[model samples]
Target: MPDQQRHVAILGAGIAGLSAAYYINEELGPAAHVTLLEAAPQCGGWCQTMPQQGNSWFECGPRSFRAANGLETLRLVHLVGLQHSILLADRRMAMARFVFLQGKLMKMGPVSAIRQIGVWNLLRETFVPRRSHSEDDESVYAFAERRFGTGLATLLSAMLTGIFAGDAKLLSVRAVFPLLTELEDTYGCVLLGALCKMVAQAAKAVAARLTGPRRRSLAVAEQWAKEMKRKSLVISALPAYVLADILQASTLHTGANGMDPQAIMVQCVNTLRAIPFSSVAVVGFGLQAEQCPWPRSQMGFGYLIPPSEGQEILGTLMESCTFPDAQPSNVTRVTCMIGKAEHLQGSEAHLVAVAQKALERHLGLCITTGQSAVGVAVETLWTAVVVQRRCIPQYTTGHTKRVAQLQELLHLNAPQLSLAGQSYSGVGVNDAIRVSRELVQLLKKNWA
Candidate 1:
């Protein structure tokens, strides 16, 4: 019999969706029919970088992609010959991060974190077992507390809170910080695993210098080339409830449609719907440099606000300092975030006001109450707000098991379906593009 026609339907138009569609057409060849579906009229989903008045730019979604783990997005850009369009932040921003702890913006420099969480305690824990039982998955809080005690755990919580914007007590260590868990599992201790890897890598480097590079066979060379050729594309908006309805309909086949139930699609959709999401608000304020409360010397990178500090805002980014083109020299462009922004009801203005109040409470030195009023601390100059409701997925407890089950369900029931998003894997833009590229290659090899 003739081979069944292959048609791939991609839901959403965010970075992952676009990347998948692009790869299906580019890598899989034109034989496959690929339909890119996006509920939003525009593409790029949350990876939007818009222009502020004048020549400056403001990112509505993710501002910067880290240049770690192969820097796939940068390679993708270079491959597309759009190198000039790519942007890089200041070196200081890339190297250092700050956290707002104990009512101060504590610079997370090379030696600074020791002041907050002692290195001696962390060192002592490293010699001990990371977990009594590695089989059971643990929350980020539980996992960190077990390995490094409460002080280190608190700091880790704040750091991760800056990353996921999810409550540390709820996030799964195996899901969110997979590397840390991998270290513990492989070496029976977290630090030992890391140390061994470093030593092994150094030894390998010396051996490679002695033995020289190994030549690859034709097939191996071709495979390596294919993997190296990075690509891009994305999905936009489609509410979870709407997606769930479609999945349910596809599963039951109880409606007017005579089609059989798509069991795989049902399971895949159900698994996706199970992941919890958090709402985040990014409030951008452009102000004169003198009007800012943070000292010029201390502003290498923006500061993250720990939830334990009882602050209303989650974190603040120094857009102007990091991305110089984000604002004019005379103006300082700073953006503050409000995690769980959905819980509060009001307009964007209200969210901005809350963030401003928090900012004043933390950074300002008032004459009377120590809290500067709105428009006084940050000096809001025609602010813009981007509210992402149910944006970042929270990989809560039992997430590792949930993901394993999800993989099995997709592989067996819905072989044609693929999931790539902040919900399943890493939330960065690099992850979206890299995962899609790898998945497309796999699909191509298995297309027969």
Candidate 2:
């Protein structure tokens, strides 16, 4: 069969799906006919950038991209001719992260010196025992506490909340922070493992500089065509539950050839549905330059509130500080993320008010009590609110095992089907690109 006869149906138009389509087109070219399916009117999934009243930009979803695991994303940027538009924030500026503790926004310094985390706790982690070989998956909180100390474990909970908007006590340590677990499993200690890895990375970087990068050539068109027997490829980048719902509907129509295939599909669907998702309310505010209460020196990426603080907001990001180009010179922008699934049920105005109160308590920002009100707090020139329900997937305990099972079932019963997106692997723009590109590479290899 000719390569041109092959068809690829990509479900969802999110970053993962789009990247998969792009890479498939780039690598396979006319070899494959790609059909991108998106249920929504707009694409981009949870990555929406909106224009504010003051010519500022408010991200209704994800705001910034991290450098780590972002090489593929950067490559995509260059491929799409967006390299010049990129704005780089100072490394120091991006590194300054704060944690709200005991009604104070505390600057979280290095773990070794931070009094909140305790110097003794750091010293004690080295002597802490590792998990037994028979032991399997455990909650993030449990792993942290067992490896480090209770204080550090508590802090990890807050950090997890900021990232996943999830409870660390429920999140899977192996699934969420695989590197950390691998370090412990291999080196018997997290800190020691990290240091060793850093040294290895430095050595690797030096070696890379000494010898330039080497690119591999793609397989010839003729070879690919000959190897390609699969007529259609279906890559699903939808949320786990959505995909499960789809599978559920499809299975009802499938004629059961045997009990095994039908049973596998049912198991996969149930596992997919079991994966929980967390909701978040992204509230953005555009303010005049003078209205920002904090001095420029004190401003950093933003602050995160630990669940211990008993605050409504998960965290706040200083958007203008990190990406000055995102907003006009006269305007400053900041975003607050409130992630309590129940709280999202409130009206938009009510949610805005909640965010306003949070900002006021955390950053001393002004709040509008009535139609007309004045106070020491600085008022916002404009406000933007976006409530994302069941947005972030929660990698609860046994997530990795569940994913492994799902993969095994799919491989046996549905070889043409593949899964990608935050639901399966890492959650970020970089992860999305990396996963999609990898899937395309795998498809190419299979066909070749």
Candidate 3:
């Protein structure tokens, strides 16, 4: 630890890496020299926004975020001065969701969703006995099936397919939905834990109303100032496999820490490589508003197809319904997501046709394959197909344990290096920003 400035090399320029760089600069100011390195020519990674003519745009990646859990994302948005461009989905529009079960689209309102999962089965979850203590991690589906029965587990699997584009049978409940696991661990029942949390949150809200808002004192700043010593730092926000490749090719130093750096690297690299990923193809379609056959009653956030349906596409998002300003008033936008890494072998046109066929089957739309409004009622304004290979990290069973091991190895062998991004803890814009801020604060506190 010295008074001199330190160099902070941040790998990747994705949302997580960008957030890390921004936070470090804001926290350390002139005390650290931040360098952002990206393998791609452009930043933002999977958060790609493609522009179309007529002042419209297509979100080839994640279209909208859950506002309730996106406090960090909102803070970042305000910091970057894009607050004015923000659009909120209508409350009703956001709630109306559908699932392509059987042959037709079934609207999943609160009651219908519960009925689909069986209300008796859900009620029985609280009475279900908790499992005995075990070190091994379980799949999301297994955890659900154990507590809530097969109905709930099946629904969870379908829901997870939409979120992670991954098989819920393979996804780790501890890594993917830690809150669910934590609830079960703490209360022996997820429902009981949720009810307790709600009551506690309500109590806190009432207390806050009477006491007014809490004030931040200068003690935090004083502590940070005292710990603001200089130290070299390398924050990696790259994919786990990519980072493993980089580390495997690089040299390391064993210091006086007495840990075997070579052994640590080998284990770390193996763990990183073991973290699997899922690819997806996002097919965006823009159609004339007048020509669109989707009814107003059916208008809402688009539908998700469960694996039981044996469909080629994962789901579709009604972009125009969610974000009205994203397209012109005359244009209706929708995006189809095709999951599975192996399904992305054909050309972009072939992918577009596949998406179109799915839409035709589910939505009963008259559309041609890879053609724009040729003898079709739905006048196609434009179409875009983006195939993202190995994009979403699949936190499979034992993912949490593997990550813990990787962190321990890095802490012992390479104290200067740290990992962040969707590959590690959480996977979302909000999670990225939140972890980046947290990592920066931790680095500031332990800079020496």
Count of steric clashes across candidates, in order: 10, 0, 0
Q: Compared with the true structure, what per-residue lDDT tens digits does model 2 show for residues 1-448?
A: 4635689999999999999999999988888889999999899999998887877777888766776757888899999899998888757768888888878777778752257667777788888888898888889999987877677777788788777899998999887777677778878898987787688777754453222211010112122323346658788999999999898877532423454656767888999999999999998888765434565445789988778778988998987877766667667788888887667888888888888888767766664631112222344678888888888899898887778767756654665677878887677788788778877887776766
TM-score of every candidate relative to the true structure: 0.82, 0.88, 0.89
Model 1, 146-255: lDDT tens per residue? 77777667777777767788888888887777767767776778777777767877675344323221111112322322332222211222334445566566554231
Q: Which is better, 1 or 3, measured by lDDT? A: 3
Query: If ranked by TM-score, best first, what sequence of candidates would result?
Result: 3, 2, 1
Name the TM-score of candidate 1. 0.82
Off by over 4 Å in 1: 1-5, 201-243, 252-270, 289-293, 341-343, 365-379
Q: What CA root-mean-square deviation does each model show from the true structure?
A: 7.1, 5.2, 5.3
Which of the two, 1 or 2, has more lDDT? 2
For model 2, give the RMSD to the true fold: 5.2
- Which 10-residue window of candidate 1 scores lowest in summed lDDT? 212-221
Model 3, C-alpha of 2: deviation from truth (Å): 12
Better TM-score candidate (2, 3): 3
Using TM-score, give the best candidate's number: 3
TM-score of 3: 0.89
- Give the lowest summed-lDDT range of ten residues in model 3: 212-221
lDDT of 3 by residue, 173-237 (tens): 87877767767777889988878767877785345323321101112222333333454678889
> Which candidate leads the pack in lDDT?
3
